[model samples]
Target: MKRNILAFMAVMLMLCMSAQTSQAQLKRFSIGPYVEAGFPTGDFSTTHNPGFGVGLGADVKLIAGLTAVGSVGFDYFKGKTIDNGNTKIASAKVIPVRLGLRYQLISILYVKVEGGTANFTGDYNNGTGALVAPGLGIRLLGLDVEGKYEAWFKDGTHGFFGLKAGYNF
Candidate 1:
């Protein structure tokens, strides 16, 4: 937890410096809501199954084609069975704080790389942690679609892939 906070603060400091450097070229801010679905890609011996998440987020254009995004989300998962006839059934709700940089390829298409923490709670795990993720996004007809891969590095490292859809304003 302490380490995560320190890392977040460090990233924020860097963002602040970047913001200052690009203040003159900053664009406007935009807010939107999003829904995401995540799939587990490894063994789930003692954890919940694949999950779905939904939340709200916003983006602020800091440079010519760069944007900073932050979001708060809740994820729910159903537990699964493991070896040795042991069934682990549980549910979890997580809060994911994300910051990303978006590079616009055109008027409606962009690519993004994001990283942040996922604070989890509920019937499974009782701890908070951070994960680094990178993703790509595209906009079409007022809707945005994205796919991201997240790697969590704490006690043990694990990875997951997520697909999200939303509307951008």
Candidate 2:
């Protein structure tokens, strides 16, 4: 897990350096906090309710309409069942770290693709998974409203659809 995180950071650093050298100047940079909700999908939907989370995100403009983006967040979901017949399963928690690139389609609309790792903790669930999410958003008056689908691959595939709202600072 540590090695994976370190590798991710190294790649991000390299990208940043290369962008700085290649671009004449960055268009913009922003950082902000966001609140998000996740609706479990596939088999995961049967066992868990909706999840809520909070995160901090940053964007570095590499060119006119392209940006490098990254975020770290924590999410929690309540279980629908009392037990899985063996152990008591009450809730689940996830910590996700992600990096991606975003392209602005127009002035207010953008699309993004991100991949990273997520740490899961819950009853009978403890491990790390590779995660991928593709999303679209609209930026209005410094506020962002976005939606995406996220899939985590570990022992099996767990997926969710997420909505996020935030302000850029």
lDDT of each prediction vs. the true structure?
0.69, 0.82
TM-score of each candidate? Answer: 0.75, 0.81
lDDT score, residue 30, model 1? 47
Q: Write the per-residue lDDT of candidate 1 for residues 1-169, one digit (tens) a residue.
A: 4565456556655655665577636425545678888887665324657788887666667678777776656666667765665765566566677777788888877888877877767755667777787888787755889898876654575567889988755
**Per-residue lDDT for 1-169 in model 2, tens only?**
6675566567656755665577537435566789999999987787788999898777788778888888877888887764555544567788788989999999999999999988887753688888999999998866999999988888787789999999866
User: Which residues of candidate 1, in runs, are more than 4 Å off?
Assistant: 1-27, 44-47
What C-alpha lDDT, on a 0 to 100 scale, does residue 143 get in candidate 2? 96
The CA lDDT at 24 in model 2 is: 30
Best by lDDT: 2
